[model samples]
Target: MSPDFLLLYVNDPDASAGFYGKLLDRAPLDARPGFVMFKLDSGMRLGLWGTETVKPAPNAPGGFEIGWPVGSDADVDQMADDWAARGISIIQQPETMGFGRTFTALDPDGHRLRVYQPALRP
Candidate 1:
């Protein structure tokens, strides 16, 4: 099955939603006391749910990164610059790795947000 929904456990749904809204430059599709949702331009759904309301307690944020593959190395660098200018926390500076050029940032809840350009094949 194709993965469509990506859910994140956040300390405060509204606050997290605000952060994402500003970064994505898109208003949330749904917002409530402990929940918010956004439909990304790619037709992917992103959900922010309050940690306290989760059925089972979550370990912590930042354990895994959400990888966003861009078209080129320049694209990755450009995005990194944009995010940095927007006041996003840049945990990892842009650099070329075995996979390609990449950079990482953190959300309000410390969730890893990475953008990369895949290394070209021979």
Candidate 2:
């Protein structure tokens, strides 16, 4: 069996759509007033729907945010620059942890998303 895609529900579709659009450099697919979808290169679809309509899975606190993995610290820097330029809130500046470098951003519904990748392979 194979896994399908994931969809997130947000309080504001326009803000969520705009955020993902700038981040992904493309407009959402199958967009409607109440929903939008991002078709990632990984064949996984990230979708946004009206918050009031979502039914969270058991054992889940609503739905957790998504992430984008970059290749290096430089890439993380560039991502933060781009996101800031687009007026998206960068909750945390890029910083190196024991495992890697990362930055967090809050989406429309206040979900925190972190983008990161391995610092080095041990």
Candidate 3:
């Protein structure tokens, strides 16, 4: 089965909405004191919530993160450069690994996101 949705726990909903909205170029579909929802154009859903509202995964960093599989290595490189230019922190540069081309970046709250393109098509 395909992954259906993702939720991110944050300390501040407004700040997270501002950060994500600007990055995603869209406003949240649902907004509340403790939660926000962004309907990603990629057909997935992202839910943001206050830390107090949900239980964290055991030993997890307890935050939100997102990654998109790009079309090619060039796309990955361009995306990394573009995000870096926007002042987003690049935790890892695009590089070839066993998994294929990949890079890692962090959102405002220090959540880790890894973007990867597979080496071989399914």
Candidate 4:
């Protein structure tokens, strides 16, 4: 099966699209009142669909998180700050963990967005 796409159920596709467009620094590949899709640098497609429009509406909100890996701890910190400056809510501050330094933020629709820096291995 293919693993190149992810769809997020949103309360309002247009608002979600605007929020993500600014966050990602790009426009959607396709956008309508009910849906929006974005092609990331990794070639993965991220879609935002109106919750009420989905065939099987999401059972509930926030069962998953989308993660972004950066080159280093500094980068993770920088992203967290950047996102906060843009009005994104930083739910978790940057902190080092087994994997690396990381921070978590909430998207307009309350989806968890995480940025991390992988710990180096010997």
Q: How many residue pairs clash in all the candidates, one count each?
A: 0, 0, 0, 0
Candidate 3 achieves a global lDDT of 0.80
Candidate 2 C-alpha error for residue 122, in Å: 2.2
Find the candidate with the highest TM-score and give its number: 4
Indicate whether candidate 1 or candidate 2 has the larger TM-score: 1
Q: Candidate 1, which segments miss by more than 4 Å at Cα? A: none
Better of 1 and 3 by TM-score: 1
lDDT of 1 by residue, 65-113 (tens): 6888899999999999999998999999999999889999999998999
| Residue runs of model 3 more than 4 Å from their true location after superposition | 1-3, 55-65
Q: Mind giving the per-residue lDDT tens digits that candidate 3 earns over 1-122? A: 99966877777778878888988899898998778999998788888777766655323333555678888988888988998998888989999998799899887668877777878857
Whole-model alpha-carbon lDDT for candidate 1: 0.90
Residue 77 Cα positional deviation in candidate 2, in Å, after optimal superposition: 1.4
Q: Candidates' TM-scores? A: 0.92, 0.83, 0.83, 0.95
